[model samples]
Target: MSKSVPHAPTSFRELEAPQRKAFFAAWLGYLLDGFDFILITLVLTEIANDFGLSKTRAATLVSAAFVSRWLGGLVLGAIGDRFGRKPAMILSIFAFSIGSALCGFAWGYWSLFAFRAIVGLGMAGEYGSSTTYVMESWPVHMRNRATGFLLSAFPIGTVIAALAYGVIVPNLGWRCLFYIGLVPIALTLYLRRSLPEAEEWQADVGNRRNVSTSSMLFASSRRLPNAVLAIGLATALVLIFSQHTAGYGWLLAAAAIAGFIVFAVQVAGRLVPVMLAVMATVFCAFLYSWPIQSLLPTYLKSELGYSAVQVSTALTWAGLGYAVGSCVAGIAGDALGTRRAYVVGLFLSLLFVFPAFALPAGNVVLLWALLFAMQFTSQGISGLLPKYIADHFPTRLRAAGLGFTYNVGALGGAMAPLAGTTIAGRVGNLGTALMILAGTLTVVVAAIIGFDLPARIGRAFKADDEKASSAMTERNTTRAM
Candidate 1:
């Protein structure tokens, strides 16, 4: 006879040793991601000055890293799906850690840009692989909270970077700050020692092994059109940067985006609507966030005339808010559902942007408080994402779907720095530029999640759950026979 299923753990205290270990390992990976990625933001002004670059040029360096993130997500996410989460996580950590170290040795702007791109590849890969590993390890009932706690590691890393900047950059210079990014490499050892391949993924792989190669080939072919459309959009994005001054460039980018959306509707697949919703939601969310995350330090230092120490202090406050917000988001997500939590946080973020960006630049205390509030609302929504996105796909597609939707959406973030700087130059006010971009995008995200997405995604998730339950029953019955 088939054995009875065991009771699922309901709390952190209830999790077995391996489950808790997996969570911490993934959390550490996210922490290192935040540190290495945001380190450039903390020292953006110093890097620009050192390289004798203009605002636009400095922004390009940030964009360079972002442009490759989607590719990393696609490649490494596939690796996670096809091979195993443990190996994928190990590879991602080593890649970013080594890439971060190489930044310190860069000779000039292009060299630094290239190095950061390498960092981006690893950083993007880490999220999907690590998140899938952790989420699969935990009980389904606790996923929202567990994901929240895992993502909180990112902002904590931001806080650490801020503190490191204050301590290291002034004395040892910006290069030393980057050198510190290499520290996460040691985390790879902990990960390898502590974690195994996710059991869920292994089971899924075993079930799929007997599937025909022809069926796999057919599925791959079906996705080719979406891939082609994605590639086209990416190219148009590059043109936006490469041809920013050209009037037709804007028209071309707009046309490309419109074309992609239209194609999604015409595609006529069950996943089309889901992907469209996810793509739109993630794209807009990044648009809202990246202006602040990428450019706020420059705004504080260059525009407001704040010192590096003051900027670090401001970031610390924001980081703390993000951390608290993440935990609260997890709890709220569990109680309210991911959709409501996301919509509420996004709506609040839209309201908070005006005060955060438009208030008097002279009052440092007010600025800090507003920033904390803004990050709390805006970035806290991030805590909902790992659970929100992962629930949509099965174990087989989990890594690839998470990686694609999230990282491809990062294209919006990839554009934000350059776009924000360009607008700031045209508008003659950094705060106004930021407000316009952030406020507009927040509305887009809130509306998509609140109106267009929830019912459809909920139905899809429920169907998947019922299907899995049925399959389990059938398997157990066959074994008993």
Candidate 2:
């Protein structure tokens, strides 16, 4: 029997009603995922204090969450590909909401860690489901922009978390944060009520009667691209985690070990002078910036001697800056080629990373500027990685391929804190640790350029779309006759 091939949407408004509804549902799901993920970062110290755990222990708990998330992404990606996007998304939301709420009731470190890990599992399902849903629904012309807009939720959710830390955390406490994280569950209801399953998913399922989920993801035709994309994504994730883990001083020894290993190998090469300069600037920024965002309450209680309210206000600004950066990067990424956008953002980040670290302590304006620039560049560049994945694969195996690649990067990100913290411990300066991170960013930039991502991405996207279009037309004609 011939299949009825659906026409792809031509413009933003041309997106079918079902597709639009699915996009919004998936968008909100992602936004909440972002909120739940970032909320933990803001309240890490408080949670550590409540559990009477050391920083290392707390970092371990966070890493555990990442590991669960990585597993979730792999498993859910395959599931979403097999079952359908809507069901996978609904299940994901249920898992994450329950996990997040459980976090609020944790009585000890182990319980809290377990709860957070559950949250990660829920989060793992989100990106793969949402990315596949939107990619399938939108026209190719608008795919980049739609993907960028969908991802902008990450920063927006994070910005909201910043506000919660500044305003809600003071009034309610850490437990309340988890309670607030439950808001995303509402999105699941919206999904069930409003969103329709993609026609593509329905058709694939109907045609491939006996195919197993694992075979669908790793079948010979799909396996090679999946492995290569996942590895590339893993490398990017490593870069993100290295920067974040170092900046926050999450894992001193690991960061140092990694930095020394890189440095000893003379990885900096001809870029050493530039890298050093960037590192110096980042160090100065870190001195001024860290206290406001990472240790805001401590800064208020100890240094500036302000009340909790004042401390919250300062942190909110930092979060807002982070959110703005993410949004701008997403929008910009669609307009510029993803590769060019990322390279520009990374270079700008290198420029800002040093200055951010160099800013004098207690300089609020400089601190805010550095945070805004750093996060804007960091999250902004980071946001483009997924879009690259989406562009690289076809609808049939997009979720598994995208998820595997992206999560491999996420696994790398998971290792960042350990690496960063270790380096800071060795160097005896948070600023120096950030300097090392900037140097790494420089290396990533070179790799990105040298990698020739534009040509690679363009070829993959073009080939897949042509095949899909031809197949779709054949199916449509067969149905008509």
Candidate 3:
């Protein structure tokens, strides 16, 4: 008997009805996640005034959300890998929505901190499942564009929050802004009823069942106890740091020590070098991004003295730039390689920061233009991350692996708001602080992605090869079925 080649969609237009449906559902999930997440940023000033918070204290709330994000990613990723993507996605959406709604009920800073942590869990959880689901559903050839379009929802979601801020916060107040989060609860039901599980996940389920759940979760039986130890120590250390007024250095050090223990135990040793490089890249990536995402509004309103209307207008322009950059990055990733796209995008972003931040605030047109360029390069490159990281793992562990690497690396982001504010206080200028901090991190990311670190470490991108093999196997299996 002869083997048949499965037909693959070469373009988004060619994708089947189910494939498109899954993509849209995942897109909406990510979009709402973005909306909920950005609400904090938009309302940071209001929340601060209402609660009498210092800049540093206000930033800690952002860090608090980021610190707990890894937990959501880890748990939900495992669930998605083991049970099904559809359920995982739905669960994450529902989780975050509830978290968002709870924020309205917060009576104080501590109450709000705890509530936002819940939102963080849900937000990170949604990313792991939704991205994995959409990637598995779309054709491999078009995965870059598929993931890009999916992630564009993030910036667009921020724009929606900005618009909502202008309309609701001015009239109904910031609490009502969060109350709108409950609307996504309806989306979860719709997704559960309409979206089917990814075909690739369905095909792998039988084989995954043959393997022990323990091995699947930890990568080896020998690593189980060590993994548990690492998780416990890390969790304790992070919680302690998060609850206190710890400095960014202390937080980063605590996370580093915990990460080292996990590596020493040989957890997922098969992807050790790649994982390290990715974690480093992700850390730097977060450091580069969070300053803008978490602090830009504060900078504009406080440092540059922009009015609320001006702040929202500038952010909307930045959001538009982010959306355009995301689509362009997808095209670049497909045309070039993922690493190439990352390097160029990150480098350009680094260069644009001077004009974006250091320029005189009096030039409103020029300021908006510069902001667009800054976000276009910096935020747009984020579109590549979902496919770039997801491509490094097998279907059975796709969610788990992606979640672990991405969210763990996101710990660096948790430190960024505090880091940025600290630098600004010392230097007495937010623009200079942005350039110093974000620029340095951007360079580090460019070096890691642009250079052949894998080859120097003796792997020569083994993960990419494994990913290709997995894709071929999945296609063959689909045709056979």
Candidate 4:
């Protein structure tokens, strides 16, 4: 995506020392994003009880946050392009950390809802900044592995949330999880003090035509607006109420939304087909994927009669799997070709994972085992995107492009809980509700069939690698002289 990116060192071990610091900052920020989201998921049951919310209403709070994410991605992403990734990342992290802390003080459903929306805005910004910064800084050949490693850190947050809920909630209560959000502010300060912009990003800023994101999206034919509205409507409905019956209403909603999206995507193809494909892929994948973290804690407790520690342990194992899967996915994507790794590898893994949800009571070993495998496989798909998106979009608009695509897809899939929980509510089987969404994986696989993104970027990567390597060599020679 970066036209003037410096050449990669032959191996990741040779990555510029400064880039490693940028990567660490992005990784920590993403890890906190994971911690914040899953922290809320783990405590949803308590939040509902505290606020006298129906399952749907509680999920609505999560839903509103998802909807706001697109806007956050757009706004902050543009800022990353205009100001610098470092500044954008710093501001975004602070906003979310403060928002997470404020969530602890929420007195009612509306108050929490509002705070989460603010957090959502920050979350979107973090996603945009982190994905853009890390992918842009790395060598193209190893982008998948780097992005996967970064993406994997997110689940670690979920794992931490599970542990915190298990340990802190019993002793300190649910508010403590929100309070924990403030701790990442330390990361914000660290980033401010140490983080640097990628050389490619620096190169692009000098001569890029800067346009507002609003102008681009509003004028980008049906590509942006159509994707946003069609997906938004369906997800909002599912989140607000599944009383029309969980699976039934969602099926219709998905169908109607799909129809609108299909029509919108029929436009003449663009250079960034990978971006288009990923946006579609994530929208479908996340429908089932996210709910595993967002709703499973409550589901395991309510239906399976698990104690707090059991839920925590099960999810922790799953989170470990998620971490492994994300890392493996990147390497696998590079090995098997990103297409097969995601479509086939991730899809087949999801199939095996479905049975875990239906586990009978007291089979703790099997529960944790299945959950571990499922998360490992299910999570692998997410690891591929940062590299994929970076490869497709131009450097100048990279953050906004990645941000919009990621959040728009997230917006579509945002109703996973509303839809999944509603089915669980109706049929009284959380596992089965999850099984119903397994078909979404097919949509993800199908979208990737036409992409040969690596081929498209090969020349650019080769050129940039040589150029960057040359520049670095020159700098060293100058110092020696």
Candidate achieving the largest TM-score: 3
Supply candidate 4's per-residue lDDT for 248. 70
Q: Write the per-residue lDDT of candidate 1 for residues 299-361, one digit (tens) a residue.
A: 988888888889899999999889888888988898899889988998887767898877766
Off by over 4 Å in 3: 1-7, 210-252, 259-269, 454-481
Model 2 per-residue lDDT tens digits across residues 1-481: 9977766554557777777777777878887887787666667778878888765456555554565665576668777777777778888888888888888899987678678778877887887788777766655445566676677676677667767777777788988988876777777787887788866566555346424345644568867765664454334333443244456444543443343233312212232232232223223322322222333333233434545455555555555655566556566766777667766776676777677656655676666666666766755555555565554344555565556445534543455455455665798755556567555745554454447543344354443353344356435533542
Give the lowest summed-lDDT range of ten residues in model 3: 206-215
TM-score of each: 0.85, 0.72, 0.90, 0.80
- Give the alpha-carbon lDDT of every model: 0.77, 0.60, 0.79, 0.71
Clash number for each model: 0, 31, 0, 4
Model 2 ranges with Cα > 4 A deviation = 1-17, 199-207, 210-212, 215-315, 318-322, 453-481
Better of 1 and 4 by TM-score: 1
Q: What is the lDDT of candidate 2?
A: 0.60
* 1 against 3, candidate with superior lDDT: 3
Off by over 4 Å in 1: 1-7, 206-270, 454-481
Clash number for candidate 2: 31
* Model 3 pairs whose backbones collide: none
- Model 1, position 322, has a per-residue lDDT of 91
- lDDT tens readout by residue for model 4, 53-122: 8877787667756756766776788788777777888888887888889999999986787688778888
